[model samples]
Target: MSALILKDFYVMWKQTKVLLIIILVFSCLPGAFYPTFAVIYAAILPYSAMAYDERSKWDQLAGMLPYADRDIVLGKYLFGYLSIAVAAGLSLVIQTALTLFWERASDNLSPLSTIPLAVCVGVCVLALTLPLMFRFGVEKGRLVMFLIIFLVCGSTGVLTGISSDSLDGGYYLSLALPAAALAAVVLTAVSIPMSLRMYRRRRA
Candidate 1:
C-alpha cells in the first residue's frame, strides 16, 4: 500500500511545479479576494490528476501488479487528499503574506483573519469534491463538480440573504466549521468503499 501510494506521488510530483505556479498566481491576489478562488482551484487538482492517470492507463497497469482494487482506489484518493492539503497549506501562507503586505502598505497592519477563512473554504471544497471524484470517476465527476459549484454558490447566496449574521465569525467557527468537517469525514469514509467496488466491477 505504501509503495503504491509512493508511486502515485512520484507521478504527481512531475507536475508539482505546475501546481506551484498556479498557487503563486493565486497568491499574488489579495488574501480576502484570493482565498475563495484558491479553494476552488485546489479542489480541481484531484480530479485532474485522477483523469491523467486514467488517460495514461496507469491504473490498469497498477491493477495487473501486486495490488488490489481497494488499494488502488484508496491510494489514489489519499494522494489526491495529500496533494490538496499541501496546496491548501501553501495557499494559506501566500494569503497571509499578501494580507500582511497590504496592511503594511496602508500602515494599518493588524492580524488578518483570512487564514481560518481560507481553511474553511478549503475544507468545504474537499468535502464536496472528494466524494464526487471517488463515486463517479474523474470523467463523470466533472458533472458533479459543476453541480456542486452551482449548489455551493446558490447555498451561500441563500444563507447570506437569509441572515448576514449567520456568517459571523463566532457562528461560522462554532457551527459551519464543525458541520463541514463532519460531512467531509462521512463523505470520505463512504466514498472509499464505493470507489473500491466500482473499480473492482470495472476491472472484472
Candidate 2:
C-alpha cells in the first residue's frame, strides 16, 4: 500500500506542486473562485496521475506484482485525500490570512458555506468518477466524467436559480455543507469496495 502510494506521489510530484501554486494564486482571487479552484484541483489531480499509470500499463504490471486489489484501490483514494488535504489546507490558510488582514473579507465572501461546498463538490465528483475509472480506465471513463460534471453543474445552477432568495441565510452552511460533505465521504467510502470489486474482476 505504501509503495503504491509512493509511486503515485512520485509520478504526481510535479503536477501536485503546480496545482498547489495554482491553489495559492487562486486563493488570492475574489469571489468563490478561491474555494472552487481548490476543489477543482483535488478533482483533477487523481485522473492526471491515472493517466501516467494507464500510459505505462500499470494495471497489467501491477497484476504480476504483489499489490492487492484493495490496496490498489485504497492507494488511489489515499492519493486523492492527500492531494485534497494539501490543497485544502493551503487554501484555508491563505483564506484565513486574507480574512484576518482584511477584516471585512467576510462581507465579500462566504467561507463557511464555500469551504464545505468545495469539499462536497470536489470530493463527491471524484468519488463518483473513480470507480468508473477503475472499471473502464480513465480515457474511457472521461465521457462519464463529462456527463456527471454537466449534470452536477446544471443541477447546481438550477437549484441556485430557484432558491437564490431562500438559500441566503448563513445557516445553509450549517445545514447544507455538512450534508454535502457527509454525502461525499459516504460516496467515497462506498466507492472503495466498488472499485475493488471492479478492479479485481478485471484482473481475474
Candidate 3:
C-alpha cells in the first residue's frame, strides 16, 4: 500500500512544478480568490491524473504488479487528499502574506478568517468530488464535476444570502466550517468503500 502510494505521488510530482507556479500566481492575488482556485484545482488533479492512467491502461499494468484493488483505491484517495492539503497550504501562505502586508496597512481583511474559509472550501471540494469518483470513475467524473460545480455555486449563493441577512461573519464561520468538515468526512468514509468495491468488481 505504501509503495503504491509512493508510486502515485511520484507520478504526481512530475507536474508539481507547474502546480506550484499556479498556486503562486493565485496566492499573490487579493482576497479569497486563490483559495477557490485551490479547491477546484485540488479536486480535479486526481481525477484528471487517474483518467490519464485509465486511458493508458495503467490500471491493467498495475494489476500485473502486486497491488490489490484496495491498495489502488486507497492510494488514489490519499493522493487526492495530499494534493488538496498542499494546495491549501500554498493558499494559506499567500493569505498570510497578504494579511501581514496589505491587511495591516488597510485594516480591510482578517487573517483569522482565512483558515476556516480555506478548510470549508476544501471540504466542499472533497465532498463534491469523492462521491462522483466513487460512482463514475475518472472518465465520467467530468460530468459529475460539472454538476457539483453548479450545485456548489447555487448552494453558496443561497448560504451567502442567508448569512448576510441573519448571521455575522463569525456566526457563519462557526456554523459553516464544522458542517462542511463533517459532511466531507462522512462522504469520504462512505465513498471510499464504494470506490473500493467498484474497483474490485471491475477488476474481477
**All models: lDDT?**
0.57, 0.69, 0.63
Give the runs in model 3 whose Cα sits over 4 Å from its true position: 13-20, 103-106, 110-117, 120-124, 151-167
- 14-58 in candidate 1: lDDT tens per residue? 856576567557655552344444444555565566777878987
Q: Cα RMSD (Å) per model? A: 4.4, 3.2, 3.4
**Compared with the true structure, what per-residue lDDT tens digits does model 2 show for residues 1-204?**
989878888887755578656666765664454555655556667777888889889888988899777888888888887777776676677667777787776555454346556656667777887888888887777797686567446534433332234356455555676777789879988988898888777667
Single out the weakest 10-residue window by summed lDDT for candidate 3: 105-114
Model 3: per-residue lDDT, tens digit, 1-204?
A: 777667666666674557656755765565544454554456556665676677778988987898777788877777777776776676667766666777452353432354445555555566556655655677766787787566545544444343334337656667777777778787777778877776776666
The local lDDT score (0 to 100) that residue 15 gets in candidate 2 is 52
Going through the candidates in the order shown, the clash numbers are 0, 0, 0
How big is the positional error of residue 78 in model 2, measured in Å on the Cα after superposition?
A: 1.0
Select the stronger candidate by TM-score from 1 and 2: 2
- The number of the candidate with the highest TM-score is 2
Kindly indicate the candidate among 1 and 3 with the higher TM-score. Answer: 3
